[model samples]
Target: MKKKLLNQPTFLLGTIITSIMLLMTFIGFFYTPYDPTQMDNSNKLAGCSLEHIMGCDNFGRDIFSRVLQGMGNTFLIAVATVTIGVVCGILLGAFTGYFGGWIDEVIMRIIDVIFAFPSILLALVFVSIFGTGKYNVVFALGIAFIPSFARIVRSEFIKYKDMDYVKSARLAGVSDLRIMFVHILPNTMTVLLSSIMIGFNNAVLSEAGMSYLGIGVQPPDASLGSMLSEAQSYLFSAPNYAIFPGVMIILLVLGFSLMADGLKSR
Candidate 1:
């Protein structure tokens, strides 16, 4: 399995990219060349120099520092969003699928209604209603993700629950919870992992979009989306301002997407 995974170019490349991004994020939480928020009036929009690896923004803040910080924020939000979605999704899907009946019908109906709208759109509405901030974005996107995760887990559960091995386990007095989680869940990891990668990618883009609309991360804090939003006005004056964040977003999304592709290929 290890050798096969390593043999995949998509997995190798995606692993490299995401590993680098993760390293940058981990480092950004500790050290940076300049305060991401620090502004130097005379140094505003300065071109890249040894002292400012990526140059300075309109506010004279180090674009490198802000870029690092933006990556951190985006990653943090994605992690939080996936955490919520996975926990809730797994539970809901496990229960509904293992014990099917009116309860399954009711829950599935509710899921259908939620699925009618895009997760980000649902998140957008939630952010609009709850007011904008990082946690709010996490919450909105997290809940919006539940339906998809649940559906995936549910399908897997339904398929695995009736297998001869499951019947033997049931006859042997294994708890339903154990059967669902211990025996069946691991089998679903192949598909679930791919979905997780896609979910992380979606979270990044959704957060970026919400922040671009100026309703997501807010000022003083740097986020890729918010940085992209801030960079828009300076496109002509400082094209690199937009370019840097745009590139990071692309890399981030691409890394996860490629990772998903690789996982699916396996």
Candidate 2:
């Protein structure tokens, strides 16, 4: 498997990008060139130099440091939201697909309603009700993500639930749980894994959108979206401020997208 992945250029590139971003985020936990939030009026708006690698923000904080922190925060939120979607979605989809009765009808109807709405729009609604915070963003996006995951998982399960191996297991007196999870779920991993990468991409974008709107992560905290939002006013004076974070977001989305494509193709 590792050898196969090495031969896939798309997968190799995606893995490299994702791995670098994760490593940078991890490093932010223990070290940074400067305090990400520290204000230095004297150094504010200064261009990149030996002292400040990416230069100073309007408040004179280290842009590079904040970026590292922002990367970590954005990644954490994405993971949390995706995890919620995956766990809930798998359970709902698996059971409904395997059983296929009145319960499937009712649950699927609800998922359909959610699926009809735009994920960002539904997330906006939940954020409004729950109020603004990292956790709230996670909750809103997580809920919004459930429908897509459930729909995918359900289709996969329905397709495989009655396969020959599943029937053999059933005849062996295997419990329904074992049949679904042990026998069938493994068969769905390739598709599920591909979807998971796509899900992470969506989560990253959604969180950035929320933060850009001033309702996510909040001020004094660094998020790529919030940073871009805050830097808009200085577009001419400090174009790099926006450019740096914008690039990070692009790299992030591109990395996951490539990964998903690679997984699907492989």
Task: Tell me the deviation in Å of residue 40 in model 1.
Answer: 0.7
Error of 1 at 25 (Å): 0.6
User: Cα deviation in Å at residue 149, candidate 2?
Assistant: 0.6
For residues 1-266, what per-residue lDDT tens digits would candidate 1 score against the true structure?
Answer: 97888689999999999899889989999999899999999888888789987888999999999999999998999999998999999999999999999999999999889989987788778977999899999999898889999999999999999999999999999998999999889999999999999999988998898888887788999999999999888888888888898899999999889989999988
lDDT of 1 at 45: 85
Residue 125 C-alpha lDDT in model 1: 88
lDDT agreement with native, every candidate: 0.91, 0.91
Model 2 agreement with the true structure over 1-266: per-residue lDDT tens digits: 97897679998899889888888889987898888999999988888889987888999999999999898889999999999999999999999999999999999999999989998788789888989899999998898999999998999999998889899999999999999899988898999999999999999998889899988898798999899999999999988899888999999988888888888898
lDDT value, candidate 1, whole model:
0.91
Collision pairs in model 2: none
